[model samples]
Target: MTLPVEAGLHRSCCLIDTASLSHNISVLKKGLAPGAEIAAVVKSNAYGHGVRIAWRAFVEGGATWLCVDSLHEAQELRDDGYTGNLFVMGHIPPAHAKTAVSLDVRCMVYDRRQIDALGEAANAASRPLRLVMKLETGTQRQGLTIEAALNLAHYIARFPYLVLEGTATHFANIEDTTDHSFAYEQLRIFNEYNDILTANGFRPTLRTIANSAAGILWPHTHCELVRAGITCYGMWPSTECYVSARLLGKDVDLRPALTWKTLIAQIKTVPAGSLIGYGCTYETTHESRIAVLPVGYYDGYDRAMSNLAYVLIRGKRAPVRGRICMNMCMVDVTDIPDAEPGDDVVLLGRQGGESLSAEQLATWAGTINYELTTQIQTNIPRIAV
Candidate 1:
């Protein structure tokens, strides 16, 4: 059968492994206690694996709690027939609190104004609204300060219309060993707050502070639930997390669930001393064969990776020559005698007998895998296989 060309660049399509996702869920399950449910953090489109697909696989893999960034994300899941516990991890503005309550979505309460609004909305509708209070220890991005958190907890305890269903803290550096002590400090503050709540006769149904890295490396901190994001996709939250897990004698046999594949847009043999790509960043040192790949910065491969990366073509790794343009890049393939047009190219996955990981690509970009995967443009199609 002949292949049909799609519109635009149509470079790489990502293949996601629903099975690996299930496997990772199983691995995380081993860390939880009986009846402890995991909240699959599907925020940011399941960290770029596509939200709907990840949500389906997550539910099927035994996750009952789903966490998202906004009411719209929770509504998207609801629209798709997901009937389970849904919590908005990020703050939902007071304007959106009614929608969250009406949709049966829990909101994250980070400030006093949100709580007051939620209480008023819930009371007017004859419904009790659920919210999780976020405590800020050191991250200093969101969440209430120590004194504010204490006051909020006490005030919420007296508010009958507003139910504090959970309390959570997000760590700024859960993946760095040097920052491990900082993470511990956050946990200590969380524990102290928990103690204060208990003493004040304010008991929340759930208390959680562990993210993917903390859940994997610091089990003692997994109070009642854990918010897992990157690890669910088989990507390590950070190098320190993986190293710490290894040192702790825990086996997190994770396989990356996303694979990106494209095809040769064109192939040609250029004469010696020929200049290549925009700004002529690279020149042909010798008569060489090159393959044009229809993938570039616009697709989220990153212009920073220009002239510093490689792509897998015909089971061989070829150095990307010159600069990576918005729509294409070139790889020298002179040594691969049979390389040709329409041949499959691997940008971030297994190709024939070799493989390339986003981790390695992130290193080349001087960034992280999370950034690389999340930066993938919305234009590309993602398929689950």
Candidate 2:
């Protein structure tokens, strides 16, 4: 098999700094509560950083838990001989209960039918299947009501092969704005449910509530495990999240680990008043030298960034000149006279004194940084440096 780094034929690739990834996890780990373990969220192909390369970096940074969205991801990890603590935080189809059982992954469940299937599978395997209940505090997605949760807890107790090992809830707007009143309210409800669970016969030892934003801003939510999604890859959940951290005097630093880059395919000069790209959106104001990059919307560069985003060429800014196409985009290199074919251009990364951040690109595209990186096509090679 050809190693990922050996994919020399691809003109563009996401350069993943494993050191930066590891350091980001280490930094996030420091903010967690005592005895709390950091669980790196490696779902969506490790947020498009390529899970096969990202897992080891996070592990080196002291993150022992790996949380993927689906049982398929868990099975892939297991098949690859990864024996680390794996947690499936997403829905597991009842049809795949046998597969889930053989993988020995801790699955998050809320529905009774799915739980029953898993219980039966556990009995068949003659092994204990650990479960984490997703509690519904406010977010209506993938959770059970307090009474319903208590009921499920009791039902889970009926199966000697099943163990309710944990409880998890996601904050609705924890990172959306600096004001966290809504998030606090959600936490309040979660705490109450936990208290009720403890009062009953079932008490989950592992409590997961703190995501990347909460893990950095609030110590109280740092229960037994912190699910750090974007934080593991070195980016804040939001500007509001960063502002909140500063307001709360939370000292933390996160380094961006992924760099989207491509080689300039060609260069050409266009006369003044010349139309460029699909919609003729940009008209050249002057004679301009443009560098065509061998990457476009298909490679995860948002088309919304057309005529809006800029790339770094020879430590200079090369402004994108038109609408991004499916296989290519053009950037004005008039100012960067030294730019040429095969020259490495940074689509999102630091070069010299300039950098095109994921946040900046997402802003230009009217989206978030999380979507920006995660949307990158998985076929593109992820080179771990």
Candidate 3:
């Protein structure tokens, strides 16, 4: 079967550096213990890098385990013929339990109802369902509550059809160096819960408590396996984590794997008093050259970044002007004397001496890097380099 191809029709696109992604994975893997396996988090379409491509890159990068946010995602990989270990890190809906079992996808059990459902589904399918029990240490998210973790683990372990392959916890403050005490406390709670399970005769094959940030800054919490998302995508989980890891002399060098590039649809010189784009949000400050780029909110370029964003053109910075339309944006390229239509506009990535990053753009949009990466819609063509 043929996958979708851009075929020269591009309004906006993200050029994925598969080599850079592989390099980032390799660098992060070196930080883990000798036997610790890398479970590259490819959920949200590998943070919008395209699942099929990202999954292939993860395997090529030596990732032994692949994690997704939902069973649907796991099924997608299974359908794509990925036979590696696939873990559904998100809460699996009751109706999808059978598909999870059939696909050999390890699911996350947050509550006993889910456990019961999975047991029934697995038994009906006449196969043991592998699962990871998530503990809600401090995230207050989907995982099992602190008060019920022990009992839940023991109860789930009693099910013959439910194979508790692992236990995991997500940290709430892994990036806060000054308040890593809370993250440490989370580690302690995870340890206690793991100990309880072991004492109760449940030897969970995999035990983990660190995500991207914790895996980078608090290496001590890297248990049997770490769920690395942002790091695997070659972006820092947070600035604090990156800075701290650098100071500690840890390997923090990761090349961003996704770079946005779109061709200029048109180029023109607007008069000094001309209004640019819709709602007249910006007026030309001088008689200047402008290049219209075929990208906007529909393509995951946040509208909030209207007056405060920058795009690279001809290796020079261009300030975004006016309200971003549904399918276009205007960039002031007056200073770039040789800018023209069909020229590559770098929305992100390195161009000459200038580099624009997802983190920087996310900052301008008043969001985080995770949101920035995952928000790239499927309509934009993603190319694996």
Q: Which one wins on TM-score?
A: 2
* Candidate 1 structure quality by residue, lDDT tens digits, 1-385: 1122432346577778898888888888788755466888988878888787888888888877889998888889999999898888886888876787788887888787787778778877878888788888788877887678779877776667788887888998878673578888888988887777777766767887888887788778777788888988889988888888888888887778888777888889999999899989999989999899988888888888878888888789988898999989999999888888888888888878898888989988889998888888766877778
Off by over 4 Å in 3: 1-7, 176-178
Over 240-319, each residue of candidate 2 has an lDDT whose tens digit, in order, gives 99999889888787989998888889999999998999999999999999889889999899999999999998899889
Give Cα distance to truth, residue 17, candidate 2, Å. 0.8
* lDDT agreement with native, every candidate: 0.82, 0.91, 0.83
- Give the per-residue Cα lDDT of candidate 3 at 379: 66
Error at 276, model 2, angstroms: 0.6
| lDDT string, candidate 3, 121-164, tens digits | 88888898887888877888877764576677778877788888
Per-candidate total of colliding backbone pairs: 0, 0, 0
Error of 2 at 157 (Å): 1.7
TM-score of candidate 2 on Cα atoms, chains taken together: 0.97
lDDT of residue 331 for candidate 3: 91
> What pairs collide in candidate 2?
none
Please identify which of the two predictions, 1 or 2, would achieve the higher TM-score against the true structure.
Answer: 2
How far in Å is the alpha carbon of 221 misplaced in model 1? 1.2
